[model samples]
Target chain A: MPLLSALGGATWRLSGHLARHFSQTARRGERPGGEELSRLRLDDLAPTALSAGRLELLFGLSPCLLALRAARRRVARLLLQAGKSGVQGERAELLRAAEVRGIPVLRPRRQKLDALCRHQVHQGVCMEVSPLRPRPWTEAGEAKPGDDPQQLWLILEGLQDPRNLGAVLRSAYFLGVDKVITSRRNSCLLTPVVSKASAGAMEVMDVFFTDHLAGLLQAKTQQGWLVAGTVGCPRPEIPGSSEIPITSCLEFLWDQPTLLVLGNEGSGLSPEVQASCQLLLSILPGRQLPPGLESLNVSVAAGILLHSICSQRKGFPEEKKRGQHL
Target chain B: MPLLSALGGATWRLSGHLARHFSQTARRGERPGGEELSRLRLDDLAPTALSAGRLELLFGLSPCLLALRAARRRVARLLLQAGKSGVQGERAELLRAAEVRGIPVLRPRRQKLDALCRHQVHQGVCMEVSPLRPRPWTEAGEAKPGDDPQQLWLILEGLQDPRNLGAVLRSAYFLGVDKVITSRRNSCLLTPVVSKASAGAMEVMDVFFTDHLAGLLQAKTQQGWLVAGTVGCPRPEIPGSSEIPITSCLEFLWDQPTLLVLGNEGSGLSPEVQASCQLLLSILPGRQLPPGLESLNVSVAAGILLHSICSQRKGFPEEKKRGQHL
Candidate 1:
């Protein structure tokens, strides 16, 4: 409700002026000259827009086209590189989508596009759209006990990097995770950078957010869901750490519904999250790693872990099909 | 030999003038102010140093420290952000390594460091070192027919992005791929950007390059090596594609020494490379994918594929151990 209220307020304010300009430009069939729009800033138009926080400027060909196709966000305007009006294929498809939707298509100079995206690769396309708000976990319908036992939900705890979060979401979606839930606090909110990094996967995926991740895990456990927390490696060196049995991801069998928790980049799972987990999963290095090279990047690790667990599900190819049936 | 010759020539030339200034500054205990060093460019010092092609500017604490410790390249100088000289921990360790090796240390403005790395994240530390040259594949020793049956070598064919190349290398090294081979023709070279992206794994991993990747695969196939090439999916729609047996990566058994070949980001394996592969492996998506989201990122795919194949090796933990033995 807070997310919806905030988004509604921001969108209402933004659409008042910017949306009017966009529709007028489209109706007049006038392309805004680069010089005329050089000093235009989306934040300036929306006074409360906190530097890419309130209104999102999604860029790149995939993110732009997918954002339009998904229709998840309220797109205000579409900006294509000035000389790319005649562009075919995906860019053309994007133009047609905007036309059909009556969204203004602005052919801005590449510099304006570049400045708009802060020099991130725009692929000659940028979109001014309402921020895609992640729904609160309370709004996510709970899976019944009789629901698919092979379901897997990815729980990300305190992931700070947008690119890492984006990559993780891409992998989670591609691997067919039943759901992706992240701690709302201290986690990277859905952003343009995340969208671009995800190759536009963020546009399509419905990610749920919750402040009480540990409580959610505990509740799910009572509903016959396995809570699996990821650790870089088992550390027996720390006293009393051996209480939680660590299973190598390859050795762990996926036989039931599960919530797989991934930790932040610098630190592993928090104590509360770790305490709620029934199992600890680790990816064993193939060989002895040198100091400082011991851990894989958080995103890479997520991809590996997701693949390992998801591939073992009942949906995999016949050869990998196990005794467990749906 | 070409790689070595190029590296030797560049190192010798860099050591003449720039190396002297670094040592003199270190010896005199004088810090060059930002204004005096603002216009200095590594390329300006060496006229032929084609913008980060010859002399490498390795950055970030891990890559710098590992490069120094690896002793794989000639360390010319170390650059730490101004006022960070008295820092402790990893930065201090880097300073010590430079001091012990008589590699002069320079304290430059953050802007200078940013410019040197093309605004890439340098983590307040940068190093001027001879490029770590990847040896030609021909220089790599031939693996005999009776070599370890569990050996897995990652072969990359024409990966274009340095970040992708770096990520793959980091995974390869972390997952314990016996060797990493790439086509020298179109593959991203071993650059500092790669080093930083790899999180310093590039400093320790020796990547072998060859012009004729297909010919090498053919040669390895003759040596009782199973050549496994990756495809996005089995496309029975493509005429005559059914002839190449494409197995799900989960179902593929790693019974012998294998060469896993990953292709370029855009277009996968070339016909020549595909023809040389005895088996095609694909990661099966968990569900029906929407259009434009069918394929995983090349780097992400590599991680998943590598994890799937590597985890099945005989060296895995007891639970994952199979009948195959050393």
Candidate 2:
């Protein structure tokens, strides 16, 4: 009973229906159309379904629920595991949202749902929704010299990992970043995996993209915005690196509108992008690091750097107002 | 040629051997014992192989390399992909370490290597090594009142996710935490996945474990070490609250020995554990969070909190002696 309670009463009711359905399918020696559905791949559905504007199969409870709530994309169908009549909480809310929007809700077998999501942990929910695309930087408006000093925008150049991108977005949104821009050229797009990895932050945040990252940095610099590129622990051994002055992230005060640039996971910021920055920021390790363990994960680094900069914002709690000091 | 150079000269040499192996296997209508090896599972060999002290199949280039370098456990065997004779760089280093240890190395098919690691990017290497067990808290030694003023130990209580544990270890090591202790009960173990997720930090860092987390906290508190527990955004609306005064992590100065406690992912610190804290630490969000987007990922929070606390340690660069202020 405690297990049932932990699982929730709705699951208890749904279990009976699921059991009955499984037994019925087994007895029939066929799963009706379930077998065919379970083998369906996203690529196979690309030509027709995606062309019809249902671009992605967004899965997971948080992503699906948030996607529906955000209403940024059109939800063509909501796929719930068979026998959800007794479902409650978020799943029930998802169903209601679909109903309010007149989106068709389908009760498919769990196998079919699994196949639709490429066997991701969907939590008994998936949706056929339009892709959430990043807007161009041109639409992000010009940065004037008199812009808010506390404004911070995160620029990701050539980040290839979807999970890292998602984690960065989650941190950016949570840390109150004014805008997020990624290099359109070698950046991971806003895929469903990214949505799940972000814990659904991707559903709410508006990300901008640009093919010309270095140009944007130069333009922002000319517009009186500080462009700070992140580099790992100072590699003074590298030739021709002494020109750019790198400051410890903690020592660098955020007193003006700034663009913080993060680079690719494998190879860091390309030379052209690094050259466009007016300043270079680096996180100093508390102790000497082992050979291969020199740098922090990009997402973790982003979180630390963003927290350091954003905490210095004008209205941050208990800091400027409360006169608290470390 | 450029692609081959980027992949390394060893890969170029290994390609012909791999092509020959694949073609030979295809012509033979068999995989030459690889079929059975590919089907092998850890549980299937637990009764015999583990009883003989071969415990875990540590995979990934980093973990395998670090495990070999650390020599912490008795490595039973090292399995490299069949065509690795032509491999250089880290792979060559790994082979040299194995040879130095006099450990047997097997040249298995890539499919078998994949199966050994459950298909989680083994990078053409796998190792059958003894388990890396956490030491008891008793072995961690007592915290004297006159102990180093800047000592910081990360205490993880009931952390369930392997990846989170790994990420925390990676951050803890990178940030230079003095020691890491975790609750033995209801915690994820140091599995291969954890090792891989940690970027091989688990192979090098010595983690301590305790059955009674609260007891250890109380004992450490009595020894003049501050026990600080992390909490989410303050809930002024909780019915029976207000005893613990949570300080902003940024505002909390780390001038003494401290134990930073992080709770589980879903349900945070258990009630009993929360009561054992001398102080509570909370990271202030930069802006108002929407519903369900309240907290940061645990590992990211760990990195931020650890960096904040660790940055204040005595002799930290650019902080104490440099006279730099944010």
List, in order, the clash count of every candidate structure: 0, 0
lDDT of 1 by residue, A1-326 (tens): 22122221122234444555655765686544332555554333322232233465678998888899899987777888888657788987998999999886767788777766656678898887877878998887888757787888899999987778878888888888888889988888788778877889999987999989989998898989888988886655545455667777777788788889999987778877887778788777887787777778788889888888887887474333221100
Model 1, B1-326: lDDT tens digits are 22222221122234444555655655676543322554554433332232233465677888998998999987767888887557798887887888898876677778777766656678899877777778988777877757677888899999977777778888898888888988988888787767777889989986899888988998888889999888885655555555677777777788788899999987788877887878788877877777667778888899888988888877564333221100
TM-score of 1: 0.81
Candidate 1 local Cα displacement, residue A153, angstroms? 1.2
Evaluated against the true structure, the overall lDDT of model 1 is 0.75
Clashing pairs in 2: none
Q: Superposing all C-alpha atoms, what RMSD in Å does each candidate have to the true structure?
A: 7.5, 9.9
Docking class of 1: acceptable
For residue B56, give model 2's deviation from the true position in Å. Answer: 2.3
| Candidate 2 CAPRI assessment class | acceptable
RMSD of 1: 7.5
